[model samples]
Target: MQRGLSGQYEIGSVVGQEEVRAFVPAPLPPDPLPDLAGERGRLHEQALLACGRLDAITALLPEPDLFLYAYVRKEALVSSQIEGTQSSLSDLLLFELEETPGVPFDDVVEVSNYIAALEHGLGRLREGFPLSNRLLREIHERLLARGRGAERQPGSLRRTQNWIGGTRPGNAHFVPPPPQRVESQMADLERFLHDDQQPFSALIKAALAHVQFETIHPFLDGNGRMGRLLIALILHEDRVLHQPLLYLSLYFKQNREEYYRLLDATRREGDWEAWLDFFLEGVLTTANGAVETAHRLLDVFREDREQVEGTGRSAANALRVFHALGTRPVASINDLAERSGVAYPTASRAVEALEGLGILREITGRRRDRVFAYWRYIAVLNEGAEPL
Candidate 1:
């Protein structure tokens, strides 16, 4: 369906130096999202089913927030990694503990900024804020607040031309709409988002919104990470999921080439169908993986608890510490003492008991200020979060 130039290109000056053609993406909710019949229909059903399974897992958890907190951090790491950050899940956990050690400060800050940005977006949504350009700017501000790209206009749209890949717009893989047209393009997008007359599924809308946002390249920095975050945010806002759980960063990180190619194809060939198929498949895969990870985490917690129970009198204190570990996954004895509301010695004893049961592993091996990890629990969550 090669509809030709997805949007009009405007002749613009590059830093007032030379003329360049900047691509302005047409506003979204795309007139018609290729028809949702036959194979596409089946993919949609599978995606919905997978989402159902994911939501059900949240219901099964006694304290889904404990899982949600850790899960969101994992997403933050993966999403940031897609933008070339080297922070790992363990680094994020350790960073949150105020322990830097071998972690790169800049990378960890970027990851932390991601967490803050996501939390900000979710908080605003909970307060009944519409997912508009305003919220996007708010999130973008937090994202670049204290990281490497902080100087590149944190919350504002780019005033000068920005290009993706290569050295400059002339040799770049893609050049987004010039700065002057960004506001109007974004306003059109906001209308499409609020337009109820548009006939499109929430999932389809999210997929299209993501690509459109990326194409717009609205911000000077953090557009890629923000575009990816928009997927989960849109779904959460649309009530497609009770919690912001589905993350496709790992899938995108794994299929990096194809992911970029599909986006390019969509812009160059109007091959929305192919992109939609890939997006739905990512939804299906990511949702199912999240469900399985939830189950495995629960199993680890249950099995560890049962082992702790076998320790008799020490079981009660150890169980408390174990529960604390379930929330943080990694902690020092002092942290356990604070989180479990136990004395330092008691927390140490409980940690020792759990360690004896092979439920916790001491990571530092230092007698003083030792840190322990709920190895199995962390392993389950760290499955796809390894540095890419």
Candidate 2:
């Protein structure tokens, strides 16, 4: 339904020269509410069911955090890639272990900062912090804490006009609300998030909130990453899922064109249902993918453990090293020895046995301080995580 422009445009000057009409979005609980009837309703229902299944699978895992550890890094990589970073999952893991000379330092750092930002947000939420503008600023602060965007007022809202695509606001693809209006606009969004009286379900609420955040473009830099983070935060805050397993960056990255188009339609036509359809489908697709990935990882773990157990007298130490590698798929021999509570020589032998069995491979060629990786484990998690 072409319900007309969702918000009004205010005449504003940019770069102290050109005149640009900046958008000021209306507060949330979108008027007429979203049409969650018929097919849209079914999509929402199916997405919720998929979420339930995803959540349930975690309970069966011996260590859900193992999957979360890799998955979170994967989300960080893909989400950063969406914003033009070329960092891969291996680069991130390698960076986490120790800096490698050949890695894209700045790009990987940006991705690393994303992981930090996410962990900080989830940690605070776990400590009972309200998901408000304050938290968003804090997350944004960490997001650019040490990366390429560090000088862009990491934690501060923009104080000047910022444009989306073009060189100047006048020719930009979309100009967000001017700086002066950011605080109030963001406050309105917070109210909608906290408004219990609103009839939107958690899934619907997350979808609406994400578009609003992106449309607002509250911050000068990192707005794209922040908008994506808002979806996971809302779902987690609403207790829709016990763990932070559902991430839509891969889906959004895959459907990049349609994703942006629907967002534009929601702003121009007040067509929330269209965006909701896409959002719910993303939820279903991502949730199903996560569940599938979890099962695949479990199979790898079971199969590898079986192989380790069949190694005769060397089985005990090798299993210990394997468990440690399960915790972190990439590790040095020294690190594995310490983590698995085995002596250095014992850990080295265990790593050698696992390597001989094709269970682990040495990532670094140097004979000293070399790192080993659980190839299959990383391979499974690396799917769809390639940098674009």
lDDT to native, each model: 0.87, 0.90
Candidate 1 residues 1-388, lDDT tens each? 1124466677777654567777777677554458789999999999999998897788889879888998899899998888888877878888888655766899999999998999999999999999999999999999999869999899998888898998777878988888888888888878877788877878988898888889989998999999988988888998888899999999999999999999998887778899999999999999988888888888888888888888888889998999998889888999999999999999999988888888889876577777888888888899889987
TM-score of 2: 0.98
Top-scoring candidate (TM-score): 2
Q: Judged by lDDT against the true structure, how good is candidate 2?
A: 0.90
Candidate 1 segments exceeding 4 Å error: 1-3, 15-17, 31-33
Q: If scored against the real structure, what TM-score would every candidate get?
A: 0.96, 0.98
**Model 2: runs farther than 4 Å from truth?**
1-4
**Cα distance off (Å), candidate 2, residue 15:** 2.3
Cα lDDT for residue 141, candidate 2: 99
lDDT of 2 by residue, 205-296 (tens): 99989999999998879999999899999999999987888999999999999999998998888898889988998999999999999999
